[model samples]
Target: MKKAYISLLLVLVLFSCTKTNKKVDITIPKLTNNPSWDVVCTNRKPLLSFYISRGGIGKRTYIVNLDTEPEFNSPNFIEYKNIEELDKFIVQKRVEKPLVDKIRYYFRAKAIDSEGNESKWGYTRFSLDTDYNKNFMNLTRAKVQNVRVSTGENPKNLIDYDDPGQVSFWQAAPPGPIKPWAIFDLGKPTIISRIWMLANINRDNGWLVDFVWEKSLDGKNFEEIIDAKILNNDTFRNVIDITPVSARYLRLKINHFRGVAPHLNCVIFYTPGKPKVPTPPRGRYVLLVGDQMNGGTFTQLAPYIETLDLDLKTLTVPHYEISLDMLNSILII
Candidate 1:
């Protein structure tokens, strides 16, 4: 009886050791590097990448979350499960929210082991670097040569949409059955890939409007490149993609709800390459003199004052109000 009791005690001890060895505790994963992120304004989407020092288990996955705010605790956060799905996300790059021109976005990632153990969150942020002023067809580079209707309130406000302090907008009033339209000359032929339009939010329900964008190599003959109606639920900006067309002239015809004319805050054009710098004319030139009230005497005396070479074509206007057609003809200006 004593020998049998001792043998039972030994068996219980061995079983307890076996159970302890089978149970393994999991360790949290460590972040190896910061996330890889990029934003493309033309695509209107941002790309994100995640990495860890090592997944807790051999077969592991990840969870990615995106938010406008830095905090990741919101219930409305956009989530993606599994590493394979997260990696495949680049192919179908789409932003849940319409991206503002220069707004910042926040992203975070967490790793999950095969045993369902999750690591702490890793964070990253990115913003779109879209500067409309740098665009090839901006007001600094191009001009609104002619329009079907005259300016409604401020004459210069048609193209001066970049000013943040003023409530400057372009509007056409009365006697128009068709939509109001405007024509812009880019000063010279440029390769344009996209067009961005920001509507006047205060007037005429800017978010609800249809636009027809047409491009022309010569001002007379125009070809419609985009005709789709953009319906914005919450966004203020509308981006239109077009085939890379070498055009010097572009026209935008606005169709608004009811008979109310469309009000535009800003319009911008984007090209792939850098802005074209005018080459110096290689011959004798003449300096056409204009009114000296607005620095006209200074304009006439500029070439002589600077002792410019006779071969160089130098025209200096104090007001810099040269017409787009004249600017295009004289490339050296």
Candidate 2:
């Protein structure tokens, strides 16, 4: 029609002279800054060490577990094209939530990009205490024999398991050290929630004798409750939780059984959920035995111990730091 309108106006003037100059837009910045980074040790377990600012290039890092709220893609969190990939994405930012020696868990992390826009949520503010295996309930018994502390000096009260009277795994020492003690039974009334002792000294080094434990819910009124410190003998593993207390005959009264002799092997107990209780019971249970633990284990690892005697019930002296200050005042960090 007129040379087709001058060949479409010379192809729109060579595509506007090759987009005239230039304007690029891929879009990848919306992590709205927040983690300026500088929280080394929130004391014991709140780790959130950050500081990845070459700003204007971060790619993605959106890990959200806030308690299994789930969503962790993790492409090494794709820091981006330099600084060794944000130093391998800040040595791979970690987000592990598992703690319950008496119930403790808190988490929060956000740093999104790929064009979704995020980054305001940041918290590694301590809440993973580790070792309260479901508020510890049910199991009633975890047998690990090796008792006979007779009377060295750990008992000023309840010692009745069919009349255990004035319980005493007692230990004052210097008389005939055969100290190795252990006794267990919770087969049914467990409201307990913590008591773990796993040690490993290797190399015959002796001098271990630390105790102090007393508990009973029917075995005849006992109540001393943990006192002999200084243990962690070497391979380490010592956890005690009795904050809930509703036991049913668990006695270990050797309050001062030192190393090099007071040899106990291992002892563990943490019950509160899923030991399988729904068949003929009302609720809360774990007595039959066999499911050692597999239903809400924030952290359960054991090895060696030589005289654990734990009745669990301790809180004072960083005793879970007031539940980590109520999980850092309800996550504001």
Candidate 3:
């Protein structure tokens, strides 16, 4: 027993020495203020993986983030105690499929290290996998916004979407109804999650706006998704949160305006919130339009957008035209 214990101790000492010799020690590498990054998706969700893998040996990790806005932005300088918790692998996780859209996105990639340092190789410009089996579907979709609306001089009751008179494609607004214009031909039914309204168009430095939003699957019968109203809110065009509401049509009902600078710079629609069903893989989400069915009207959503998107950017290729087999199929060939 005594001989065996001695032998074990000798072996342990040798193992420790071997480990020490093999370790490639590194001091906290001075972060060169430069940031390197790559984007990847395991489940179709995009993750910005940042890094400062500059002249390093082994892959050491750290933690980072914007302290001001925790929820909006995630920490890039992050380290994981548990490797399992680390979303280190770049996966194309289509856990929640993106909403149907015409505009699309490709791919991006990033990297990070032990020190809270970042390198910038960001936002499009990722290497592709040529291997067929390992290839990823590298594209995104969004409706191209084309319908432009300016204020008019008269106030009309836009509360009635059922009436064709309610909306007039405006070049300019009248003195009344507060130049209400919004583009929501987002293709598929949206569970609107974010609303960014910017009343920053007036050059005169002051503006007041009262706004309400309504939505409907069948454009004729619209209802307010969020009853929250902005009464003379002096906002200089900012992002607002519109909760998850399932609808295809959205109306930005604006009434009672004052002050100046009432221009909408942009309204960016974010990904929908937690949906009812597990989102499918990121692919083409098709919606059939054209209710002109055999002298019958099915009352589909207004502003059939797909046709517009295709029409505006139709390629002069040899592909056959989209026929009855596309939108509304028929008993006849």
Candidate 4:
């Protein structure tokens, strides 16, 4: 037993001496957002940051791994090797499959020096969760119940989504004041986190260049939240992040416009948390119009047909153009 113990001690002493002689002892890279990162859930493409020790010689090669499974053994596990940079990887674009919503994701990284010395893996876990911010001004939900403008042509067009191209916009009527304001009424009080505005880039001075955001619980009383004057005319999209506030009415007051009229193409109000996604209908029910067998008009019977949890599809094509593929997709004739 003493001989065996001495032999083990000799091996340990040699190993310790060899390890100490090495110039670079590569330790695990420190992950900046370990455990959990909220940005991964909110950003479609998130940038990962990390720190590597200073002792590694020559160019460092980073290996990054991402997987849906915690074990990182899934078929979809993605590996990126030979990366020269220590930070900034756009994980979304490189993913093999679309990241499913509300699914936990695993990330790990390691570094190897030119001399083949390697570091321990640094790991993190995050999820593209249900806490995504959503635009509440969607036309489908009719969230912007009503809109009243101080002076503009078709203020309702902002929420109607009727513009075929970029040609349509809400502009102050000619001969009216260059300053125009609009108030939006959400049917119920809603918590708003941010606002997005896309202006017409064609008109240099017609955009919502200078405006103020105001909110009110009652439509009558309003308080200003932001007074913005955009100096960069090159960009069309303007986004403003605000502390989340609940209000029933939101207002946008234009202070100055240099062109013929104050103009804006689109506006979006964002609120935290994703809305529940409705299940897609399994198969479509084709309604062969002009046939006497289907007696009711489309407008009157469309709602009733959807109650069966089936999608309604109207055959707008000529009888000769009706193909087999179309018929196969429909559940009912």
Give lDDT per model, in order: 0.55, 0.39, 0.38, 0.63
Q: Cα miss at 102, model 3 (Å)?
A: 38
Give the number of the best model, judged by lDDT.
4
Candidate 1 local lDDT, 247-332, one digit each (tens):
88887766553235556666666676433333434565554434432225533465673476444565553222344544565664
**Candidate 1, overall lDDT?**
0.55
When sorted by TM-score, best at the front, the candidate numbers are 4, 1, 3, 2
101-180 per-residue lDDT for model 3 (tens digits): 22223222233434433334323212122232243112111232333243543222211112232232122344544555
Candidate 4 global TM-score: 0.41
Across residues 167-229, which tens digit of lDDT does each residue of candidate 2 receive? 222323453545434446555566656666543323223324456567676666777765423
Q: Distance (Å) between predicted and true CA of 87, model 1?
A: 41
Using all chains and alpha carbons, the TM-scores for the candidates as numbered come to 0.38, 0.23, 0.31, 0.41
Better of 1 and 3 by TM-score: 1
lDDT of 4: 0.63
What's each prediction's clash count?
Answer: 1, 50, 62, 0
Pairwise TM-score winner, candidates 1 and 4:
4
The superposed Cα distance between candidate 1 and the true structure at residue 172, in angstroms, equals: 1.9
Kindly report the root-mean-square deviation of model 3 from the true structure over all alpha carbons.
18.9
Candidate 3, which ten residues in sequence have the lowest lDDT sum? 313-322
lDDT of model 1, residue 208: 37
